[model samples]
Target: MPHTKTSDEVRIAYQVRGDGPPLVLLAGQANDHHWWDGVRDDFTASRSTITIDYRGTGESDKPHQPYSTERFADDVVAVLDELAVDRTDVYGTSMGGRVAQCLALHHSHRLRALVLGCTSPGGQHGIERSSEVRRSLVQPNPVDARQALLQLMYTPAWLATHPGPYYTLGDQSMPTYARRGHLVASNRHDAWDALPAILAPTLVLHGTEDLLNPTANAPLLAARIPGARLELIQGARHTYFEERRDLASPLVLEFLDQKVPLQ
Candidate 1:
C-alpha cells in the first residue's frame, strides 16, 4: 500500500516482500504490483522483491496523457529512491521490460542486474502481434478479454493441464483511459538504438512459443544489449515465467546471484 512520487509528480504504488538483497519487478500493461503474485514467493525466497504499479494503473495516479516507457522507467527509479536503494537487481516483462530498458539506459546507476522477459526493443524491431491476438488484448468485455488473452499467452497443451488459478487474478480495475495510456506507451517504446548503453549485466529470457512478443525478439534484444545473455524456455509462451516460474525462477535466481555466466 506504500507509494512513491515521480519527478513528474505521479504517485506509484509499490509493495515489498521477503527480505534480502533488493529485486525490483516491473509489471506489464494494465498490471499493478500484484501482477507478480504468481512468482513472488519464488523471487522473495532469496531476494527482497519490489513490484510497483505504473502510473495510470492500479493504485497509481492516472494522468490523462500519452504515456511513454521512459516515464515508466523513471517511476521505477523514483520508487528505488524512496526506498533509498542505491542499486539492485531489476527484472521486467513485456511492457515492464520496455520500461526496464529505459531504466538501464537512463538510470543504470540504480541497477545491479537486468532481466528482460518476453519483451522487445520496440519500433519495428519488436515482434508483431497477430491481428487476433491484438484484438484479444483490447477486447471490451473483461471475461472474454481474459479468456482470449490466456489463449494467446499459454499454449493449448499447457492450458489443458493448468486451468483456474492461473486465470483468477489481476489488477482487474484498470480503467479504459489508463489502458489506452499504457498501450500508447508500449507502442512508443523504442530502445533498440539505445540498448548498447546499458552497462548492467543483462539477461534476455524468452519463450520458444511466445506469440504476443514473439520468439524472434529474444536474439535481437540479446545482441543489442552489451553482452546480454539470452535464454529460451522451450515450448513456453509469453506468460512462461508465470506459468512455469518453478522452472524459470532458478534461472533468474542464478543470474541475479551471479552464479551463471553473463554471456
Candidate 2:
C-alpha cells in the first residue's frame, strides 16, 4: 500500500521487502508488482526487493492521456528518488525491459546492474501473434486477457506446470483501463538504437521458445552492449522466471552479485 507522489503528480504504488542492496523489479505490459511474486522469495533472500506498479496499473494513479516509454522511465526514476535510493540493481521483463534500457541510457548513474528478461529491442519488426490471441488481450475480462497473455509469455511446458496462477494474478492486479494504457505505451516504445549507450553491467535472459519476443533479441542485446552477457533458458518461454525458477534464480543472483561492475 506504500505510494510515492511523483513530480508529474502521478501516485505510484510500490512494495519494498527483504534486506540488503535494493533490487527494483519492473513488470511488463498489463502486469503489476505481483508479476514478480513467484521470484520474490528467491530474490529477497539475498537482497531487498522493490516492486512497483507503473502508472495506470495496479494501485497507481491512472491519468487520461497519451503514454510514452520515456514517461514510464521517468516514473521509475521518481520512485527511486522518492525512496532516496542513490543506486540499485534493476530487473525488468518484457516491456519493463524496454523501460530498463531507457533508464540505463538516460539515467546510467542510478543503476548498479541490469537484468533484462524475455524482452526485445523495440525498434525491430518482431514476432507477430495470431489474431485470436491479440483480440483476447484487448477484451474486457481480465481473466481472459491474462490467459491470452500467458499463452504468449510461457511455453507449453511452463503452462503445464503453472495453470491457474497467471489468471488469478491478472484478475487481482490488471484493470481494463490500465491494460489499454499499457498497450498504448507499448506501441510508442522504440529502444533498439539506444542499446549501444547502456553502460551498466547487464544480464539478458531470454526463453529459447519465447513466442512474443524472439530469442534472437538476447544475442542482439549482448552483442550491442559493451559487455552484456546473454543466457538462454532452455525449453523456457517469455515467462521463464516462473517456469524455471530453479535455473533462473541462481543465475540471476550470481550475475547481479558478481558480474556487475563495482563502483
Candidate 3:
C-alpha cells in the first residue's frame, strides 16, 4: 500500500489509479478504500482516482486522541500536496462528505468541483445512528461489524443481488482498532453552520430510502451551498454508490466532466 507522511507525522495509506483528471475519493465512517471498489473502475475509466484510508481507517496510522473533522480534512490536503495536485475534483460519501465540505471551506483553492453522496451538512441536519448501530461500530469485530453495517448501509435489493461482493468488501475493509476511533471521531462532527462557506461547484447525492442518513438533508445542503444541486437515488440506501453505481456513477462523472472538464 502506498503511504504518505502528514505534517503531524502520521502515515496515511492510499491508492492512486486510472489516468485522467484527478478525482480524490473519501470513504465514509467505518469504511476504508475498499468502499469504492464497486464504482472505482467506473470513475477511473475516465478520471484519475485517488482512494484514501482516513487517519484511523484501513491501512492508515491509527492515533488515539485528537480526532476531529478538521484534522481529517488536513489529511486530505496532505494527500493532495504529496501528489502535487494543484486542483482536482473531490468525491466524498457519509463522513467523507463532511470532510469534503470542510475542504471547500478551508481549502477552496485545491478543488475544482465537489460530489457528496449519502452525506449531510452535519450538526442538526445529520441523522444520528440508532444506539444499536452505534454500539456495534464502537465494538468493531470485522464479521459482526460487517453484518451490522450491511443492514444500515445497503437496501434490500442490493443485499440480495450482491451479497458476495458486499461480504468480500466488508471482510477486506473495516479495521477493528482504526474503525473504533473513526466512529468516535465521526460522532463529534457537526458542520451545519459551515455549509454556506463552501464555494466550489457542489453536487449532493442521497438515497431516498436511506435509513442511516436520511435523504431529507440533501435539499438543506443544496440550499446552503451556492449553485449546489441535489439528486435523490430512488429505492437506494446508504451505500448508494455500491447499490446504484450505474445511476450514481454516470451522474457523478457527468457533473465532474461539466464543472471540472478533464484535460
Q: Quick one: best TM-score, which candidate?
A: 1
Q: Model 3 reaches what TM-score against the true structure?
A: 0.90
Q: List model 3 lDDT by residue over 1-263, tens digit each.
A: 98899998999998999999899998877667887877789987898899888887778887766577778889988889889999989999888888888888899999999998888777767766567667875565767876766777886666777656562233245456665666666777787887888889999999898767778878888888989988999888888887888899999999998887778
Query: What does candidate 1's lDDT look like per residue over 133-212, in tens digits?
Result: 78876788978988877876888887898765662234568778888788888988888888888999999998898988
Which of 1 and 2 is the better model by lDDT? 1
Give per-residue lDDT, candidate 1, residue 174.
73
Instruction: Give the TM-score of each candidate.
Output: 0.92, 0.89, 0.90
lDDT at position 232, candidate 1: 95
lDDT of 3 at 250: 94
Order by TM-score, highest first: 1, 3, 2
Q: Write the per-residue lDDT of candidate 2 for residues 144-207, one digit (tens) a residue.
A: 8767767777766667875665621342454566667787787667777778889889999988
- Models ranked on lDDT: 1, 3, 2
> Which residue segments of model 1 deviate by more than 4 Å?
136-144, 165-170, 259-263
Global Cα lDDT for candidate 3: 0.81
Better of 1 and 3 by lDDT: 1
Q: Which whole-number lDDT from 0 to 100 does residue 94 have in model 3?
A: 86
- The alpha-carbon lDDT assigned to residue 40 of candidate 1 equals 83
In model 1, what is the error at residue 235, expressed in angstroms? Answer: 0.5
Q: Name the 10 consecutive residues with the lowest summed lDDT in model 3.
A: 166-175
